[model samples]
Target: MRTTFDFSPLFRSSIGFDRMLNALETASRIETVDNWPPYDIAKTSEDDYRISMAVAGFAQDELDITQEQNMLMVSGQKAGEDKGEYLHRGIAGRAFQRRFELADHVKVVGASLVNGLLTIDLKREIPEEMKPRRIEIAADKAMPKGATKKIEGEKHAA
Candidate 1:
């Protein structure tokens, strides 16, 4: 049986968190997802990330990687069926498509396939406007250095 979660309560008080809430809800809905061609996500640096996937028996031409919006898709398909027969076939040669949700500002840098491992590099580049900046507070406009002051109770001549 599949279970669903309600996020209506969080929607009322949360501001600018629609993406996070949606991702959480989406994850909850996919309870019995496939784990084919296992993969790992690792943080290489403060803003650098890497996704390594085991894709044995798959050639570079048979794999496709794409990014649209905040979603990254990686898929593999064998070119053709093997004509030779084997007494015991253990290696799995199946077509699979895996999707990953990426956070804002996260972009794919490069991808490589070496020794049956498909590694994808990513970098999070925060825009200049979004980065933290110190605001300069003016010191009350310096009070006009030579300005004259008058008493509150005294009257001024026109």
Candidate 2:
């Protein structure tokens, strides 16, 4: 069963959130999205994250990781090889692509393929201008030398 929602009403009132809403709509419409190459997203620290995917038969050279804006894409393509004889092919060796929507300042730090697991590390490094800052309120008596001088009210011709 598939459920549909009307986001037109939200679009009317919200501004600059079209991308977010579009992402949500895309997620909702993807009913048959494949869950191939199982993955896990973990928060290793306050600003650090890790995404680990199980790539049993894939090698580091066969995988590609890219970041475009706030989206992270990880794809794997099994290298072409001759499969001679196989009685029972149980382990699924298939190509897959996975995408992750990251927050504003999130960035990909590094990635590593170890023991059939491809782990990608991420860190959120907020810009100095965006980070919370403490404003120092100036006291009336302690004003700076040039700033202390006040001018009388004067009218200017427009």
Candidate 3:
């Protein structure tokens, strides 16, 4: 069952949150039954993240990881089918695909497959202009360099 949330009220009162609201909406509509090839997401640091997936029986060459814009996709394809007949089969070696949504400015730095775990590293690097800065509060007569001033409903460069 899928639950729908009404964000019209927030859209009417809020600004610059359309992207966040869209993400929530998209997440809510995702199917809950496609949980194969279990994975874990961890925040390694304030701006660093790690995604570890249990991709056993898959080799590095058989897996593909791609990042386009803010979306990341991971997929695996088995090379050949097993020839031996087993009484009990536990390990799964089937082709699978998984996707992950990345935040703005978050980039995939590296990835490694060790043992049966596939680890992906990510880091968020904010641009210099986007970082917070302290603004100087000048006196009435004091004006900062390259500042703009308004006079008679017209903006004047100062």
Candidate 4:
């Protein structure tokens, strides 16, 4: 099946280059791979996010995490150990690679391995100018005759 995205409106709007690049990067990465060593993305707060990946049989030293060009790459490689005898082996101790696309202003806070799961935290700090702000309008302004205020399709005439 083929999917289509209509981003014409966004391109015509005031979206910046960084945002456009980030969006395109995300779309491109989505077509690159499927779920492997399955993971979860959770939003802890308005500015914090957590990504947890199942990495059983892989030690903390065998994993690598890096952030490059707004992308987070996590990889794991397990070393073969000498064994006297083994009847059957079912656990996965092979190599795996995972990539995550991060938006602009997103930063990796830290990473930790617990109970065979690697958790990476990220935080996005929106600048003061980028945050949403409410503008307080003065109620003392005298409206001229036939003046009207339109808000969300509601028109109030004075």
Residue 98 error for model 4, in Å? 0.6
Give each model's clash number. Answer: 0, 0, 0, 0
lDDT of 3: 0.91
Give candidate 3's error at residue 138 in angstroms. Answer: 7.1
lDDT of 1 by residue, 1-158 (tens): 66688999999999999999999988988866688899999999999999999999999999999999999999999999999979999888899999999999999999999999999999999999999999997775556778977768867899
What's the C-alpha lDDT at position 26 in model 4? Answer: 61
Give the per-residue lDDT of model 4 (tens digit) for 1-158: 75666666666665567566547756855755656788999999998999999998888999999999778999998777647577887776778988887887899999999999999999998889998999998798878989998667767999
lDDT of 1: 0.94
Pairs that collide in candidate 4 are none
Q: Please report the TM-score between candidate 1 and the true structure.
A: 0.84
Between prediction 2 and prediction 3, which has the larger lDDT? 3
Which candidate tops lDDT?
1
Error of 2 at 106 (Å): 0.8
Which runs in model 4 stand beyond 4 Å of their true positions? 3-33, 81-86, 132-158
Q: State the lDDT of candidate 3 residue by residue for 1-158, as single tens digits.
A: 55688777888898998888888878877766677799999999999999999999999999999999989999999998989999999998989989888889999999999998999999999999999999998878868999988767767899
lDDT of each: 0.94, 0.89, 0.91, 0.84
Q: Candidate 2 lDDT, tens digit per residue, 1-158?
A: 67898788889999999988988888878877688889999999999999999989888899999999998999988789646798888777777889899888899999999999999999999999988999998876667767756688988999
**Comparing candidate 1 with candidate 2, which one achieves the higher TM-score?**
2
Best model per TM-score: 2
